[model samples]
Target: MSETKFKDIANQITSRIEQGIYAAGAKLPPHRELANELGTTPATVSKAYKLLAELGRVESFVGRGTFVRDKSALNQVIQPQHQELDFNFSILQPCLVLNLNALTEAYTQAAETLSPTLLAYADDSGHSAHRAAGAIWLQKHGLQSASSENVLLTNGAQHALSLLVETLTEPGDTIAVEALTYPGILAIANLAGREVVGVNLDDDGLCPKHLRKVIKQHSPKLVICIPSHQNPTGITMSVSRRQAIADVIKASSTYLVEDDIYAFLNNTPIPAISDLLPQQSIYITSLSKAVSPAMRCGYIKAPDALLPVLAAHIRANIWLASPINFAAATGLIEQGTAFELASAQLREAEYRQTVAADILKDFYETASGFHIWLKLPEHWRVDRLVEEAKKRAILVSHGGYFSVGDTPNCVRLSLMSISSRDRFEEGLIQFAELLASKPMPFSDFLN
Candidate 1:
């Protein structure tokens, strides 16, 4: 590696050390160890270590190892300033407005209604009543013809996704995802040993032209997208954009997986892409986003052709979704409490969105969902703002978390879970103060 690159790597290591992940007086890993982990050579690693030792950021004692030194006095000599900040804004937690009474009541009712035979192994698909209730529940959202045969309940969205990925593609196959997609999808792709290629997105969400290009280049086995209220960015794909993406999927023989976890609370409901190409699409929507995160219930809708394969995957992995959780969801659907709770959540989300807009009006963009995407001012970088906010006991998410094609000059603020309006404002004030202050150099904590 070039000297400049070597120093860059050294600086990164020093940053980690300062964060206390690599503690002072601890021996740095062997040259070969670091080299293998970073996919670099021992020579490059050794040179970086040598530079670090010469600068006294690390001390190499004879025969022992390199140790992080006390660099408080070395502030004048490239002592990177540390910024402490809180990170409450970027997370999509479902804590603030959850109605636990409704959830518990549903679970209790399901337990009471469970058949004596339910104690035995559940049907590989799900309970017949539960599936029927699930179909009825989805019908309210505009998806039709979903009978017990079409719905399969799973442990949760993540488990359902794992089964979908395992059943749909081979180990080395690739899938197309949004440039800035959910980390859960990323984790699943990594677990399946499948490649996840990124497609560019616009205000309407995923760009059809870019998706078409990626499909041709990678010929992915599946095209996965979260069309409604996307994670992180919280932007919904418009009807026209949704249809355009559907057209692209229908044109190709490839399958589509539409993650509609965020569909429940969206006031302006877009037609499920599954409706556009039911034969070639599989829809996974879960209650984890609305009713209760503790209520681990998710449903899958697939064409008749793929049901058996998906069922087999579920059977092999987890015999079936728990009868208890399925019963709870079914009871809630039957009693209409789940829908009520979902409506309340929508009201809460809109209120929070409005408050966030009111605070960041000048900086807000035309985006829907629960998060506010704020473009950082030219004078301020996201990392600095994050750290300053932390020191003031407020937190926000950096743009790096939701970036793919190009690094955006922005950050996302999740306003749903935070309870205190005053605290939220105080944090935002700290953030604004940091933005208005003379900027400091970036540090590890900001990320």
Candidate 2:
């Protein structure tokens, strides 16, 4: 517990460097010399220097010694402004290692199909061709009643969900969501000026008991769920759970909004909960998962009656989804090219998950989606674990970023975004090493 220990000396050295006592680009004392001067082992001194070097605040030359690096450019690499809530599990994101050649070729072909005549205030719902293609896409996903009248293309699923929220409910109306749901959905609910409530879930998702309780208690106008492969938890609703949920919503007169973003990737296709309550369920799916995110084309299959309302919202908010983006997505799906592209990406994601699990099998469980959810060891809480990972120049998501109730001791590791498998695997190794490290009490070092 004394200040003379190697850890303490390391802290003192870091403090001195941060305070400009050791000028930028200046060399520090040799490991053995610092170890002797600080009254600690050379190994401990070396460990401290290694930590600083990894942070990019300092650099080391082989056969030479460690020296401070220029900190002026440190802000960009070490720190970012306006950090978004990131998770390790989102491999298919806004843009994740996009295949430029494939995307460019597809878009180029789609561009040729767009008529200059349709560019002006054309179909308020969506371009005729895009809607036709969107309907075909929906039918492949077990959406039986997806005619052009039932489908409305939007900028993205986010836009579709937003339109639904605004069109269906007024301000202060209650809307129920899965306890740990997508933050984007929550944002839409908030923007639409609705009261968002959480319905509890078991392993299979949204327990009927809790669903009924919340419905009876709040009498919410809408209940949103990701029935197949729920986000963050990756749990699918069983047939029985789905039936129970549909039954309760029918009895309670609560409408269901199914956000089936990742449903296409499901190995076993289950009937959309909408099948049971087609009159009341608003089914939304997107190509953001199956194709690439940049396509920004998603559609909603709502009750025929609500089509006008949704279209009105679309007209006011976004007039129409991008004709070019829609055509590109349509061409891929119609030509059986999207399925091929998605299959390859899914395989790559599966491989990454396997590699991550093999390296950190002792740490936690791996889920089906692109990322693995990990429970940190007893000493490493989510925040501290994140700090440890960052110290190694690796990035990961923390559990607190997802949970709303008692913050669980878990983290979602998105394996797909990184460019190289070897780099990601090495990062996973460093993560495991960080987890295996002992905690250093702040009080002991700060003194």
Candidate 3:
């Protein structure tokens, strides 16, 4: 039978199904009958039926004939399963286990104290008291000069990023980012129709020399960076590197967007780029990772000059950050629960990092954040490792997801997503074992 003939037959049947001529749950004509009707061989008709089955337009049964499947039902069956230890992406699930007693109490107190204000539209930037709390929260992370007037509340860091991109840049504006940085920023830039240039990095984080080169070449209006415990790579900038980058920004026309989300996870305090060059920086952080993502609370400290524009963007985009979320976050910060939870999460992360270090045996360095960047062996393929881990029921993210230009031969393992410490250790050991093994040959699969 000709391949073209079978494909034609399949296409015709698919068209009929889509047109509703073949109602869902209605059985398809028998292969022999359809072949006889169309003046084709039964084998060709069987091939067409197989194609339809693969496309999920029809299902075959042993005794029962092929029947049209409900499109929505097929979609449900094809959807990916939600697994607990699936670490293809990283998130702070340790917050799930955190005691919410304080948060509950704070919420109740906020309800009474914030009273009629909580029931109405809040200030576009934030209520003065909430912004005051945000300022204090920033100070806890070592940004000593944060003031309530300059702070603007956001739904989360991701929301703040979108707002900043829209407010600070125009379409087609170039933005400089680390060579391998947070994927979220890349996604936001792509959506906003802006360009992102990658800067090189070394052990100390963003290489100032490469940054200078990129700034000179692209003349980007903004440079986005995660200087503290950067995502995927887990490299924290040394004070010298921070100063160098700050100096570069101060000299250039570029403004800096510092994603300080992971700064709270640092065991020791590190100075933010905003500290060195406040006028040239827009600093963003959130309680989503350190406290609870449910609060949807994020804070931005831009130079006073940008406040009105940022506020305008906030009003235009989301009206205002949820007043309830702001109230909860403020209560937590003023009541000190935010600090307490952050300290506890930091300790938990350190313990998991130790576990990863032991299990991986120097293959990677685990930071005081949720993830570790695992360097692959010279011959090991990152894609194959990710696939093999999936086959073993362990999910992990490959370096390609975070790469701005070329994908690296590494994988990122998230330590805190698995709630069970023992299971997380087992997963890491399994990953190490997979790394030590050789890939199976194509001929082996054939045999």
Candidate 4:
């Protein structure tokens, strides 16, 4: 371990981050692995990582590894609609164009009915009417047991996840998740100083056998899964598989957080995993994906026993989720317009999936709900492909960000972000070309 050399190592790593070779939220190589690559001792690499952490360039959790940090990563990965040039297949949101009229009408109706009571501080869970609306929304999707009394409100699914992670698990406790999962879940675990262990995923989603084995080995306090249109991978769990997983949870002492945000994207309603193990599941959903991200309306359907602590966390965090947003949400759900909007979005997704399938042809393999998990050619590494895509103003999500462990040679293309069908198709054609073409030397495209 060379003490003086660690500074140079830290600077070199910083340069890599700045150059986008090591993407934001990417897990850095293990100490010994990097040490071998750099021809240095593991101790020296650890010191360099520590220095980077102190400088706020990277973050290190207790049991989890180091990660590059950047606030703009979200904006960079999930671009806004105003950027017409960038073919952003990065943001996994519904096409905003489809919902504008309905959203405006809902909000306008909400404005007319706003009273002093609606504007005041709401209860911990939220206003009864809003909760009732969330219940209706959740029940329609899959969680038929949803009711106003058990639904808790939050800014969005992300907030609900954070709130639940805080309330249910302790720092340094192990949290099990799908091997390749939503980056947000990993982010929550890392920030909370909880250890994350990835269970292998199969075509049907999380492998029930592996999940049980991980639970036994790690003795995790919590397990989180995205049962519908899973992020990055786009694998929806089968109903029997969901029951198998629920049985795994039922046999274990751990609580399962079923993030079924994409449940609305399912053609036929598949009952939520939580529906099978009501006492052990925390189900979260939101209108953001189905309606508008600006709405910020989210719901958590928890067991009655966990309600008090979860609500207390909600109270401590933001007093309560604002009733103003929930007012619009309530109006939409009550009028039977929310389900209609979701159905329209689903149809749009179906059309987009066809467009993507036609353009990508053989390259398109994953079952898309709102995104395509296009496996890359062996010649094109995930990072290199992502970097090249960005160079062409064709932004795609790097597979590294979504991995709980190693990700396959793949990049996730969010099909719903780009507003124009023509622009969207053009981006896909370009991507298909990139996938077909072999990698060029770094010097070739530097200029």
Candidate 1: regions farther than 4 A off: 1-87, 95-98, 404-407, 441-447
For 357-414, candidate 3 gives per-residue lDDT tens digits of 8878847654557778888987676656666677777777656657776557787776
Please give the CA lDDT of all the candidate structures.
0.73, 0.72, 0.79, 0.86
| TM-score for candidate 3 | 0.79
User: lDDT winner among the candidates?
Assistant: 4
264 Cα displacement, candidate 3 (Å):
1.0
User: Model 1: per-residue lDDT, tens digit, 47-153?
Assistant: 87886765445778788877876422212211121432342664565544467777767777767776777766866477788888888766676566567889998
Query: Which 10 successive residues of model 2 have the least lDDT summed?
Result: 73-82
Q: Which of 2 and 3 is ahead in TM-score?
A: 3
TM-score head-to-head 2 vs 4, winner: 4
Q: Which pairs clash in the backbone of model 2?
A: 88-413, 88-414, 89-413, 89-414
Candidate 3 Cα RMSD (Å): 9.7
When sorted by lDDT, best at the front, the candidate numbers are 4, 3, 1, 2
Candidate that would win on TM-score: 4
Clashing pairs in 4: none
The TM-scores, one per candidate, come to 0.78, 0.77, 0.79, 0.85
Model 3 residue runs over 4 Å out of place are 1-81, 85-89, 92-95, 99-101, 111-114, 442-447
Q: Choose 2 or 3, whichever is better by lDDT.
A: 3
TM-score of candidate 4 against the unseen true structure: 0.85
Tell me which residue pairs clash in candidate 1.
85-390, 86-390, 86-395, 87-395, 89-414
